[model samples]
Target chain A: MNFEFTEEQLMIQQAARDYAQRELIKDVLERDAKAEFPADHIRNIAGLGFMGMMVDPKYDGSGMDTISYVLAMEELSKIDASVSVIVSVNNSLVCYGLEKFGTEEQKQKYLRPLASGKKIGAFLLSEPEAGSDATSQRTLAEDKGDYYLVNGTKNWITNANSASTYILIAQTHPDKKHKGINALIVDKDTPGISLGPHEDKMGMRSSDTHSVMFTDVKIPKANRIGDDGFGFKFAMQALEAGRIGIASQALGLASGALERSIAYSKERKAFGTIIANHQSVAFKLAEMAVKVENARNLCLKAAWLKDNHLSFGIASAMAKQYAADIAMEVTTEAVQIHGGYGYVKEYHVERLMREAKLTQIYEGTSEIQKIVISRDLLK
Target chain B: MKILVLIGNVPDTTTKVKFNADKTAFDANGVQWIINPWDELALTRALELKETADSCIESIVVANVGRVETESTLRKALAVGADEAIRVDADPKDAFYVASQLAQVAIGFDLIFAGIEASDYNGAAVGGMLAELLAIQSVSAVSGIQLENGSLKINREIDGGSQTLAMNLPLLAIVQKGIAKEPRIPAMRGIMMARSKKLTVATPIEVEPLTSILSFELPAPKASCKLVAEDQAKELIRLLHEEAKVL
Candidate 1:
């Protein structure tokens, strides 16, 4: 196994770093405080072709490998993970899904814009009662020949108001349970579609998290991603790949906090010497560094497996669960290293701590990851 | 007007500089390389010129004097905007040899832009040597450039202020920051298209070396800092006057 990153991968990392350092980081503190969407930043990154890094070039994507996408994700998340989540959903869930399963006409009409950053896309799966138990989808879709009328409320939608296209998972045959679920591509401008006010989130507040309600929304049958009952498999596969994205994001958040602590420790003095000279403080930094490195290896391994068309389900689960846990632990210690400043918002570690919690809970919760792992082992 | 931008390979800014055991040379293990920042900015401006109008500025070419590693940087330049790249196979003996190699490759181009100095060595010599060898007027610390009528106006930063000079085609320039507002990051499509873009490897015109590296050393580290508590104004003043020797 080669440990070195390819030249193209390194270049992608540099481009992402340059853009994040120059543009996304300028007003980031203020934007996080005000919970402002980075529309301009998104547009600029789109110009760099980050929005659809892994999609095929024929479909307006950059046709990059998953490893490159993960590298970009890690870089973007280092400074502003809220912005990275919006990017992650677009690339891992929306773009990858449509490219892998959607028909040619579907790809031509919908995937191109999402791939080109002309429009944002959302993947709708979660609901009030179905967070971890996605199989219990309550959203209903009534078939009407050429179109299907869908009525459902999806909670925790990442780009609810901002997205132009949505992959809505709804039940077509309630009698068949999960086998009845169908995935439809619904436009945001469709009739009877309404978005609730943005949820006041503790962290990642800049992302447009909301409850999207569709009342008798008519969707073209042609917009279905695959065969009638392919929604469950499609979602499972997409989330398996998407877990790598979240794992990389978590790794970024932890590493960013650790880097801040390292810089601060050398600069902040306590007893006639810098705090880093103290063994207690120095050991903590070492531990944080080790954890971040470990998490990066696991995350990259998962992404590398997927890029090679290998079975990555178990590897991805482990990576996400491990990285998410490490993110929380590392950020907490990072704030502690800041002393009382960690409790306050200005130090930024507090924000990272808050943001890191969601990584453990979203995509697939730590508990669900265990289930995925155990199931793979049993099989 | 064909513009040939000279590219240089330098250590990434974040790489820790280290000297060898005998202090004769820098340790080369696991060193990361990147395109010299100033040359990258120059290439970006050349592309910008071509982008604005296709008339005088017809094509942008980048030339580098190194082996495969340096060609990797040129590929990135291609991804950024350079239409053609010429990689000369050589060890980059000195500024004169590098300049001569570039001078040979830049024979047909009307304008040439290169970084004022390479970050690794800070020699600030290649651009001037190219001008001297090619028999063309040259300027350094160029911050900005604009195309007007049939001539290109160049802006240079001097000791106290800035000045602009209009120069005809076929002139060499040593450029700094204002050449472009910012260097363009290669787009994904650009990186994709770069895989197919023409990267020509040229036979180096051998030149006798005029200089050679001798030794390497790192600067001294800063002294340890002393913390001054909020309540110790008198103590701080005493130490500042007695120990620091400034009152």
Candidate 2:
């Protein structure tokens, strides 16, 4: 297998790096402290066609492959995961779902704007009771002939305040189990839609996260994706593709931490020389480097499988679990390498550690990914 | 008005410089190539001018003189919004040779831009040589360029201050930094479109090089820093006087 990246892929990576290092790193600390949404930054990247990088060019996307998407994600996540999560959800979940499953009319009306970066989109799936057990969705969408009335509370919804379109997943018939579920595209301006207060998150606070309450929201039947019972499969497939995005993000965090630790160690003097000259500190750096490299390989492998139209479910699950776990481990080591400075905000390793915690818990929790892997082996 | 940007292929800014065993050639085994920083800034300004409503600038073309490996760097310039590219199939032996190759393709453009120097060699000679060969007026140390009512308004750094000059077409600008805020990053669409943009490979004429490298050596590593305690004024003075020899 060829390990070299194409010229286009390398150029995309450089563009993302230029933007992240030059723009995002400027006010990241202040935004994190204030928990501010990166509104202007979102607009900037959207203009760069990052919001829909992998969608078809006919639908106003950049028509990039999944490998390019992974490279861009990793570069952007290195400086600001808060911004990268917004990009990940829009590209991997909202854009991919519509391009792969939505009808032509739906694509024309809804996907066009999102793919062109004219609007932001969100995926509404998780409820307060259904974090990891996605099959236990309690939100109800009552069938009303031409329109379906939706009423539910979706918890931890990212881009809740900033998105213009939402891909809502709800059950139409509780007795029918998952087969009764349907996914619909709903306008954010629809009446009877209200958002809860922004959750005070531990890290990635710059991302707009809130609980959305849908009460008697009417969505037309024309908006339903795939047949009447395709919501479960659609969500699963979308998340399977989405794991690559998060895996890359986690890889970025680990590598960013290691780079900072290396730079700090060489400059920080302890007894008589720089800390990097000490074997203890140097060995920790080596281990962090190894973990980051492994995580990168896993992420790229999963991306390659998806790009080549192969079955990537198990590979994605493995990547998500391993990358998320190592992100936490590497960031912790990075902090320890920085000694007392790592506990502070300016050093940035502390914030990376905080962000690493969320990667393990979201998309699919580490426990949930293990279940997916073990179940596949047993079958 | 059509604009032509003189592109130079150089190692990435962060690359560690290394020489071959004989010290007669650069060791380029793993060096990553990029557009010269000043040229990138010049291209950025050209794109900005083209975006204006009253712009007379029609299209921007980038030209480079190098072997096929430098095609990627040329393509990168196209990815950042150049309308087309031209590559002269030859090794750029020196500034005069590069300018000679560029002069063959740079004719008929209303305006030509060359960075003051390439990051690698810092020769600072191509733009002047090209202008002299083409029998056109040249502007040096240009930091700002704008088009006002179809005329070119330019800014250049003087000995103690800055000065602005107004010039006509068929001129070459030797640009320095501050030509633009920063080089524009290629958008995803731009990267995709770059694959289809026209990159013409022109035949190089026989030209003798005026200069050749004899040998190469890297500068010595920086001396270690010594810190003086806040209360140790006497020791600091003694060290600076005896060791540093500047007191």
Give the number of the best model, judged by DockQ. 2
DockQ (C-alpha based) per candidate is: 0.77, 0.92
Error of 1 at A152 (Å): 2.1
Report the CA-based lDDT of candidate 2 relative to the real structure: 0.94
What value of lDDT does candidate 1 attain over all alpha carbons? 0.89
Which docking class does model 1 fall in?
medium
Q: List the residue pairs that clash in candidate 2.
A: none
- TM-score for each predicted model, relative to the true structure: 0.95, 0.98
Pick by TM-score: which candidate is best?
2
Kindly report which residue stretches of model 2 are placed more than 4 angstroms away from their true locations once superposed. Answer: B53-55, B229-238
Q: Candidate 1 — which residues are off by over 4 angstroms? A: B224-247
**lDDT tens digits, residue span A45-94, model 1:** 88899999899889999989988887888888888999899899999999
Give the C-alpha miss distance for residue B157 in model 2, angstroms.
Answer: 1.0
Q: What TM-score does prediction 2 earn?
A: 0.98
The DockQ of predicted model 2 stands at: 0.92
TM-scores computed on chain B for all candidates: 0.90, 0.95
